[model samples]
Target chain A: MPKKKSEESKSNNKGAVRPDGRKVDELRPVKMEVGVIERANGSAYVEFGKTKVVAAVYGPEPMHPRHLADPEKAVLICRYNMLPFSVEDRKKPGPDRRSIEISKVIKDALSTIVALEEFPKCMISVDMVVLQADAGTRVAALTAASLALADAGIPMREMMSAVACGRANGKIVVDLTKEEEDAEDAVDVPVAMSSLTKKIALLQMDGDMTLEEFEEILNKAEEACSKIYDMQREALLNKYEKEGKEVNINDE
Target chain B: MMSSKLTAEYVRSLIERGKRLDGRKLDEFREIKINYGVSEKAEGSAEVMIGNTRVVAGVKMDIGEPYPDMPNKGVLVTSAEFLAMAAPEFEPGLPGENAIELARVVDRGVRESGAIDLEKLCLVEGEKVWVVFLDIFVLNHDGNLIDAAGIAAIAALLNAKLPKITEDYEIVRDELTDPLPIKDIPIPITIRKYGEHLLLDTTALEEDVLTGKFTVTTKINGNICAMQLSDGMSMTKDEVLQAARMARDAATKIREKLFKDKLKELKKA
Candidate 1:
């Protein structure tokens, strides 16, 4: 017997099971590769389902534009670029207002762990390119860029990991895809944290939700980010292993 | 930072002893890392890190009028930017001579090697064709930017996909048709000669004291695609031939280790 359209819609919304069959609290599959760019001091490639991002780190070298050079510390710069065909619509090349805002936030988040003062009169640059984006690219870029910086052999107090959670349908969901992102009344909450200290480095929220729901989403994001932190560490360790270097994972 | 005479002399002395300050053999390259599909928005993108030097290359495709001379073939434009934040020496704004030279070297390698099958990119005979824009950025410069940039550019092209074109002539940005046809992989190897010693992948400090440098682009089939020589000093025919042989050997190793498996995986997708 054919089911009614209304009945089908209701059943689909009941458990908030996504089109890809992920539950409200589930995350998309993630893949990480470290030291992927041979020309950068450090580089990483990350994939969160269909969302893909690449990050490269270069520096502790002398800062350009002499005036911007801090005598007491190294300056950190982060740039994020999305290609024209990354989305359903073709985007123009170059930095747009949205990219500029995201770049600033990512820079601020990374500055927390970067021991900039250790290398005076120098700078560190982190460049991220989103080759394909389904959703949650900012978080993916942050996570990948941090790993790239680590791969560059930069001194850091701790590493940072990021993940996004949002309200889709009527329930909280982790790692929303583009379809879920476009749903009515959808809210996105992206959170980044210092892996060792467990302190929030970046927190941005959009849409509307109750305070309790927000707290639950944050908890879910934290849990997901923790898992990502391990993956980031593993990627870094694997690169060294491939180079025949012994890495003590517990040294941190 | 200016190169010090003391540092140059020290490097020369170390080279004479068959050693580098970083504790590497004269012909040994530093660690290489290549990652593709870094940019979600571009048709293709790659990031390459050779030791401390970092470069990112992104390929974008668009429909445009074909050139009168080559109406049937597609167009490939290459440009390079040396970000000011990458190094103290690099200035922002317009590309300097060094940046222009880097782009030309990479472009020559790809174009001459016929790495991309441009004929397949044509839409209309003389009216419309696909234009591939390959943009490279040097995010960090520890030296050997030419080799790194070339690798990134080629990898980005290998990773590229064509946007679906409807029968009605509408270009669909979201749906990808298939991977662009890649004919060959041309790998560039830059060698710096410091006094009598020839060094591979020179660091910035080493480059400052280099007597001369030459980059040879070799294809997977052990053929020379393009060659560039710069600086005041010159190399003899024998030296150039030796460099070519070395570059070919290195290209083969890189093709096998870094690209073979990845290319297979990309093809499967």
Candidate 2:
């Protein structure tokens, strides 16, 4: 609730300033790294401001309980979990209504882009663990999980990015803080997008807003997610470069 | 029987020509049939059939302590029970993720809208309040369960009677007092993307091969109460906007055709 630096609202010109003094369009500082876990086939860590998540991918292997396996395609399972200490209150370990819903949404988002047909009768698992408490954890987890999949060498149509954009204090902003997210007037919309394809992989909205407000936020989220997409690819390329592997990430 | 791969290919072949296996248009929903007051004991009930997909929703009232956060508001719970007889793949045990998502989508749509006027359900502010339970039972899974369940919920809630509150702060199960305080009608419109086509109210066969779906719950005033995109599919920014626009139009059609009297009453009010 404290302002560090004063700035004007960029797009809406509502004359409303963010609580944290960020521009309406400015995203929080982001950090992304791939291959963070050596034991996992692929793993990545992503942070958006105070929110942090680590994602690991394992699969295209034999699926347990053969009945759940797809004979012509791989089954994609995603679990989004938060460490007990990730929040202010000690969250009881295990999936609650919130976590179960979050996990399902993340899985649905990933299922669209992953090339499941490439591995028949196999299963792919993507696990994301939140290490810090903050708003936009689902988006953070999704951003990390996609990178983990790419790092695992699992085929994908495109590398995706996710972000939460909403209205706080009557001004549209990207990557809201937990404080702003809980505000009465908040209009929280979490989205996942593929920049190159101009596709929306996941979308969910809560709080209150008009149709026009929702549309404006969607445009903003698209721009923010595309920017995050570039950052994700850069982090991935950096990983390959560090490993001394010649990965010519072609524009095609 | 054709293999799933073959059936999928056959379905896609039909969709490529803007056709459906059942001779319906790309955006055409199957005929919706509604039967009210099927349950005499329940406070409210409705059976909705979209094509061969049948679902029943029942409303029951309970008196309970209010939650700490909002003591003045009553609680609304929407749950779905998928019967094994509904489909071969469905088991009789716990509610699966699909059932949970169906319930949640319905719940959010109802709660986000001022449909029930939760504040009015409160009797003794922080102590006693009415807890409304809306349960959806799937008797058949022909596809597009969300829309059916959503419609049944709103329909049942519209006709639901609030049980009389006793002097002792208890609910009289058999004695009905008045109708539930219904304000807005939120209709969930599910439009899916099949290749480049945006299909509405798909049947079971068509749902199997669809790439993406957007379940947007639009209120009568054209404002959105809830929105969800299912599966790991992606749509262009244009497509996303198109879906929202489409939802509003479809919701309007559904309201005019089904809840004509209700909307007329709402307008008169």
lDDT of 2 by residue, A76-114 (tens): 989999999999889999776678788998898888788
Model 1 residue-pair collision total: 24
Per-residue lDDT tens digits for candidate 1, residues A79-187, read: 9989999987898989865676577668877887899889999999999999998999999999999999999999999899988887888878888998888787677
Question: Each model's DockQ?
Answer: 0.01, 0.62
Query: Per-residue lDDT of B49-82 in model 2, one digit per residue for the tens?
Result: 9999999999999998888889999989889989
Task: Give the Cα error of residue B12 in candidate 1, in Å.
Answer: 1.4
Evaluated on the second chain alone, the candidates' TM-scores are: 0.94, 0.96
lDDT score of model 2? 0.87
Which candidate should be chosen as best, given lDDT against the real structure? 2
Candidate 1: segments with Cα more than 4 A from true spot? A1-252, B262-269
* Local accuracy by lDDT, each model: 0.81, 0.87
